[model samples]
Target: MTFQDYFPIWDKLDPRQQNQITSRLVFRTVQKGAVLHSGSLDCTGLLLVKTGQLRAYILSDEGREITIYRLFDRDLCLFSAACILRSIQFEVTIEAEKETALWIIPVEAYQSVMAESAPVANYTSELMASRFSEVMWLMEQIMWKSLDKRLAAFLLEETAIEGTRQLKLTHETIANHLGSHREVMTRMLRYFQSEGMVKLSRGMVEILDAAKLEGLRDGL
Candidate 1:
């Protein structure tokens, strides 16, 4: 798809603004494990995901990672352009969760357009608010929910996203996403296996009973 196809506010901008953005727009692809943007120091431009997945996360001082949100096809990522979004203080690392195709609008160009266009600025605000809401929900989960419920919810979410009962994930990887230790995740997975909610393999967990998993996730 072209820039116009992915950008919702394309028509709102006039010819000059459109030209400004298109001139600096860059199309690129990255491998699954590639780190697209690291920390709050690098202004990596505004990321428009044309295809595949991206994970946005933050790391603690102790090096534990917690996913804030994820971007998929047709998603716009504002946090990548941290220089333009000056209010964002925390560090966020964005990585390619799958081989991703993207259109990057250089921070300066996008910022210029945003300044000139009310629609673009409004869109940016809405997107930022949405991301912040997701982060708040994650914080609530971390603070109030128990680990078992959180893990069950994560597993169910993965199953829905991947559309498969078998998830090819290691304990370490799952722990990184949920901001926990691998050993704790392993113990939880073992408990789940004993309860017949899931069957664990070397690097995979297959859901044995979705109903039971849902019950656990919902505290039913």
Candidate 2:
């Protein structure tokens, strides 16, 4: 799909306005395993995921990568208010998990477009609010849920997206996403396997009993 096709705001603009805004947008293709943004670097534009997946993570003091979020197609990377008003550099590192397409819009040009279009301004505000709510929900989940419960939830989510019970994940990657240590995840997975709820094969994990997994989640 074209950049405009992915960003519906393009349809709301007049022909002249569309051209002006389009001129400032650039499309770039990122290869798998590429680092799109680093936590220490300053990024002045917004990166919109047009296709594929990006992992938003941070490096710990001990030099381990801890995943904070994942961005899929149609997700906006840097919220407009955070980029413009607060002038805060994005706290997470964005890395391409697969070959991905992205639309990069300069912050200055985006602000100019918002100034000229009330609809765009409102959309930007709404997007920021939604993002904030999602972050809060993630925090709540981490605080309230047990590790096993969180693992079950993550497995269900991955199954829904991948359309399979088996997940192509390593213990380290799962640990990073769950904000736990690799050794901890290894022990938990072993327990789940012993209970016949899941099966581990090489780097893949297969959910063997969905009902038992749901029970674990409900009990948490």
Best-matching candidate per lDDT: 1
lDDT of 1 at 57: 97
Worst 10 residues of 2 by lDDT: 79-88
Model 2: per-residue lDDT, tens digit, 1-220? 8778777677787787777668888888999889877653455478888989888776667777666678889888763224574655546677888899988888777778789898888888887777667767778888998899989888888888778998998998899887889999999999999999999988999999988988898883
* Full-model lDDT for every candidate: 0.94, 0.80
TM-score per model over all chains: 0.98, 0.89
Judging by TM-score against the true structure, name the best candidate.
1
**lDDT of candidate model 1 versus the reference:** 0.94
Model 1, residue 35: C-alpha shift (Å): 0.3
In angstroms, give how far residue 4 of model 1 lies from its true place. Answer: 0.9
Candidate 2 residue spans exceeding 4 A from truth? 59-65, 79-82, 85-90
